[model samples]
Target: MGVRSLPAEAYYGIQTLRALENFPISGLRPLAAYVDACVLIKKAAAMVNGDLGCIPADLSQAIVQAADEILNGALRDQFVVDVYQAGAGTSHHMNVNEVLANRALELLGDQKGNYQRLNPNDHVNYGQSTNDVIPTAIRIGGLLALERTLFPALADAIATLDRNAEGFQAVVRSGRTHLQDAVPVRLGDTFRAWAQILSEHLIRIETASGDLTLLGLGGSAAGTGLNTHPHYRQRVVARLAEFIDQPLRPAPHLMAAMQSMAPFVAVSGALRNLAQDCVKISHDLRLLDSGPKTGLKEIQLPPVQPGSSIMPGKYNPVMAEMTSMVCFQVMGYDSAIALAAQAGQLELNVMMPLIAYNLIHSIELLGNTLAALNHRCLQGIQADRERCLAYAEGSLALVTALNPHIGYLNAAAIAKESLETGKSLRQLVLERGLMSAEDLAQVLDLDTMSQLPGDT
Candidate 1:
């Protein structure tokens, strides 16, 4: 590795180059949000250090300018380390440092890789270590993702579902539990339930994210605050809060914060919980939109693509299918994040690179998938009123309402006779003298039975 040279135009230096060789695993680069988080940290550190006179004003200005340039969408490709590189994300952290240092060197009217002018570790990464910076980056990355992607996406999806629920409120359909008809339910209530589920998930995600605001940025190599200015922790956190417009604060216990990855695990767990519900909702959509000719096509999902390669004129629940796949992937990432979170040793968790990638990726993937599903499928769903009414009227479980008018045993006998004789429940009940036609009609009213509690 001695005397090796990088390309003259390359902003990343020898360390990133060595990482390129050492860990040729997964060709993936650090995520955009992850890079922005690291750069924001670098920018804040430069500002604080310059203010405190820990680094020269001109040098700090150069570093700040370099970070700003990256923030403003420059040198996006300079972070070249593989995502699966060095433990604790040291490789990627150095990648950020080297890229900013070389760019800062260029800003100072010097050539790249001229560390004699300004070193990546000594200047750009002053008072910061991979242990602290990577953790802080994970936190910042998570917050950024939540604010910019997941929260807004969830809000829009929930609003859409609420609207759909209100629209379908009058359409009564058969409710199924354990794949068997249970009772009557308004189709709108089905959507309203989904909306409520998403709303609760949003709350849980926000709760879990509260822990992300507590950062260990000043911990340096081991949460000891070694080599940091006396006021560096508070100043840096304040600077970062202003930079991201978040209420980021120093961890009350920097050692515990740096040593544990519980915050990330919590957020990922919330995401997994949301994914579980999403899978159920997606499956429900598929079942309701199952077939136009044979299956229970109570509702139709807007087809985004042709369902099959060979089946002509066929439509599939592709968006809902895609959502289920993404949610399953999120659940998988949550498990990985949980394991990675618990894998830390006495001082640090070296599985941070994996945690960072999986957690951030899961957030973005889920947000995007849900957004797409809402727009392409959920919002476009159309209920077949006739089909829903037919199912509601035909279900043998509708006899549940007859239990109060006739005895439970008598009602069960009527339902069993109707199923066996191909006669309607109303027909069997009237023939058996279970109740008068007028009382039976009122009892079996779909609208009355499906009305939500408190509904007029």
Candidate 2:
């Protein structure tokens, strides 16, 4: 937007330089993944435009070659625009356009900054606008990261929990509701519940991301398709689907797609749900692995590091604690995304820079944290069978087994006496001759106590 001394070797041009000077917020550049996504779109567009006779085959081939080099991560450091730059990711979009245009000029034997031969606006960004392309790139980048990172990490965590569920089946423990023991349950039951939560989170992610299959490509400035060939949308989308290996389609109403951030909001909501599930599972693991001597000590977590420098033998559930913190951060990102999604004024959302940064960052953070949690903690967790059974035997709520036969009042009386007398619920029931020994044996069987009421 202003006169400037261009860097002698920098591939980025005046627009990217202006962005760097203006928006220094966050000190973080747009992610390499986002840049690669943008380049992939340019590559596909160039191939399609050349085939449609809209652009010269030689120039289109050069553009595609530049995009390929960027896609394979040849010049990642050239994308210097800050992620917190101008809204709708204009700076970020122009940053990619300039980089690709200059690179294409190099491949064509033209010196850098020779815009007359390969203009960033006229040739490289032929049929696209920042309004449509930026958001589309965000979605594509997110989908790639989800498949290659987050989803795999999630599956690892779930499989770890699944294995522990069956492995700990015989470790009967006191079940707590509201932090008070209420009945007996197998350790497997707790893990199974956590697995179920993650499974549901996965389903929600699938359902929410299904909306992203429809894209706003070909929706040029204000979605009017100005200066673009009518068939460009269909051909480009078909090319993109084949390249992305995902079945994607153009949105029916280009203008509506360009203006709405609803799909992004839905995706962020799914991430939030997954984060909440992580928070709950992590908190439970932290509580269960609290203290080897003084706290619950019902389960032992593999010690990854020294938890405290001042205390001896102080091993903490660091993985689970870290997971909890990561989840909290993801939840915060979800809230920011929700606000940004709502901040969409008529044709564009100015908060998209934040949206793009937060969503990809949240996904990457969650993926890494989950993999660490699974490998460092869940995989090596050992059930404290003796401690679990000890607590099960000591629980006063074991009188719950007698409720079916002795009635609630009588059972409550036995429960109260067992607490006051420092005796087991079985001992109190036997002392009062409430039932025959044979009947009591069957009612208080450890395996039977761990079963659900329906099973009993």
Candidate 3:
């Protein structure tokens, strides 16, 4: 490559400069969590290399200090490589290496670009290859996302749903199947079921994330562990585990770990599963809160902003709609991750940057979407008690209660007559003498009909 000059203040070096000029792709930079994951790896490596006598103590100290500064929110803009850079994330890897190496040089009273005293490849990225480091960073980034964002958001959502369920427990409503009234149901139980759905998704996601704990760090170039110290694998993993406070271990087969993107695929698939549920829940909210005059109106969602530009006083289920959009994005990201996972050749997966971005971004996106939905929508949801009761009473499905008492054929005939004559099912049943008024009252009681089996 020809000589290219970067700004005097730039911490990134020539390789990064080449990358910047070459890959002017998506303006998106590496995510904060992704940056943190890479920096953590550098810090752990520096500490371990220092102890193992692989690098000089002073240089290792400088590198560690530089990494700490990045972790503590410094020099973030220096990671200027476009996300869609060279395959296997080599460009971004070098970007991180250059920034840390140059910063380390500065910390040692040397000028930036002084690779003689502390080089990026020869020192900062010592004993590590992009193949192993990128994959491991994806894992750590996923873990960081789960711990810092998704898990907490999920817990909050589940709690909010539980609270809503308890509050709306007594509101009986019409239950629709196939978009037609089928039976009576308590509105609260619907929220409870959603809570349970999210809880189960949480379990599945946690299970899928378990594979991320196994790493391919010491595998180096091609999982051959070439040029790596004998103790580097275990020691580095141990150091990383301590650094992130997670129990990480070396993969039994480093080649498989580096070569297969299964862990990322699994995590993304789990996110896809969760996203599907989120879309379902969001659509349900939208339907329940459809309109004030023309739609179901079984519930009211608090309006965050005016929904329509031309129509005045029009507020929509914006949070739920936003949730569906984010979930759909997660599904799309999962698809990309699956394709990337399979596209890898023998030794390395060249599609790692795509996987890394999509997987981690999906987690953070879904997490933020859920948090917004919970805070702005679910928490403020107000059930329409009068509407719920009216729907429960008016639904033709109420004839279902007459089956055991009067018989299925008789109930069907009553329902037909009620629809034809524009009369109520109760009126038809009473006129036809299907059952006594007292018995009919007990059978058609919305509270009793919608109550769960164990409810008092």
Candidate 4:
């Protein structure tokens, strides 16, 4: 078919089609959450125009009503474009603008795609630029993804680990450092540490979200608000706050909004921190589930897939491995975002498109991966209690706890003798007269070791 151009269709040009066809790696179309965010921005802009008397109240009301419909799932089919394309999201902004304008026109008894009756550019995108609107939408979409998906999934993972902690609190296990036996710890303590790392990252994510709340709505082209009316900035941002029910604040300096992408860089850093934590946790989980016979076999991860095509009774820690791979990908995306942020130039950062694409992609991936890690790995995780206790019993490193009572020299001697003789540390302690049976029992109690003296 030959190209068909509607009067107000900004993305119907050949360039857009070619770009869309070229970059098909992700194949992921724009998300509904993102489209809803775009609608929210348009609604806010319309409301601002009405407040400034730049547009008629009825037109503003109509535009907002149309946007609300879209927000509530009215024109979802229209946003069938990938997020990673050329033109700095101009195509996306115009697509949304045209959809909202056409919907508003239809509400007013006008035909769809009739830009002359209700021009998308002139009216719908009255005081905005793809430059400003796209980045703002990226932030809004990111925040929404965090709230609706990432945070909750992470919380579930934390809760799962917390429950595991409780379940394995009494099972003593040998902790390792540099892949070597280091000390005695409860399996519960190990899981609790995992939960703590996730909890800390959750705080970091919330802090990163703070940077996202500073939107560039009023900052039109070049972030000067030059083409926009003087009062437009505050009005639009305020209306956006109402529409999204988020505490969005205007960028204190419009020039900074246009020139600097520090907020995105900060968000990327937070995501990198999260990815690092995931990598660490996944790596540990894989090691803990290393082998059923030959390896440490400290814990048994729920087997979702077979380990081999030919080997029988082989279960793989596929979830852990996949989670680690996703984390590595996220770290790479974070690097891309950082490099893009560094590449920002003078009055306008032309790299906003890449930044938006990577940040949104990272957020979504992190969210989905975390959900899978929680459901497939953490929630279904089972500790090999007998195996863990056996390892603990066999480890001479448990002598570290005895050091306080028996003195470091004697503790080392006991540990060395136990290792040389291949005897249990508890039996060695008693045989060496390091402590009586009652004292050894008190010291060897995992609960006693985990708590302070008065607490126990």
Candidate 3: where is the Cα deviation over 4 Å? none
Please give, for residues 73-164, the per-residue lDDT of candidate 1 as tens digits. 99998888888988999889988899999999888999888898899998999999999999999999999998888999999999999999
Write the candidate numbers in order of decreasing lDDT. Answer: 3, 1, 2, 4
- Models 1 onward score TM values of 0.99, 0.98, 0.99, 0.89
Predict model 2's lDDT versus the native.
0.87
Counting clashing residue pairs in each candidate, in order, gives 0, 0, 0, 0
Candidate 3 local distance difference test against the native: 0.93
Which stretch of 10 consecutive residues in model 1 shows the poorest summed lDDT? 1-10
Clashing residue pairs for model 1: none
Candidate 2 residue lDDT tens string, 1-456: 549988888999999999998988778987766776788889988888888788888879999999988888788989988878888988888888899999999999999899988888888898999988988888887887787678899888899899999899888999999999878998998998898889888888878878777888999898888867889999888888887787789988889888888888898889998998899888999889877778999999998999898998788888988998999999999999998888989988888888888988888888889888999999999998999999998887788888898889999988887778787777777888889888998998879879755643
Q: Report lDDT per candidate.
A: 0.93, 0.87, 0.93, 0.80
Top-lDDT structure, candidate number: 3
**Candidate 4, position 338, lDDT:** 84
Weakest 10 consecutive residues, lDDT, candidate 2? 447-456
Candidate 3 structure quality by residue, lDDT tens digits, 126-233: 899999999999999999999989999999999999999999999999999998987999999999999999999999999999999999999999999988889989
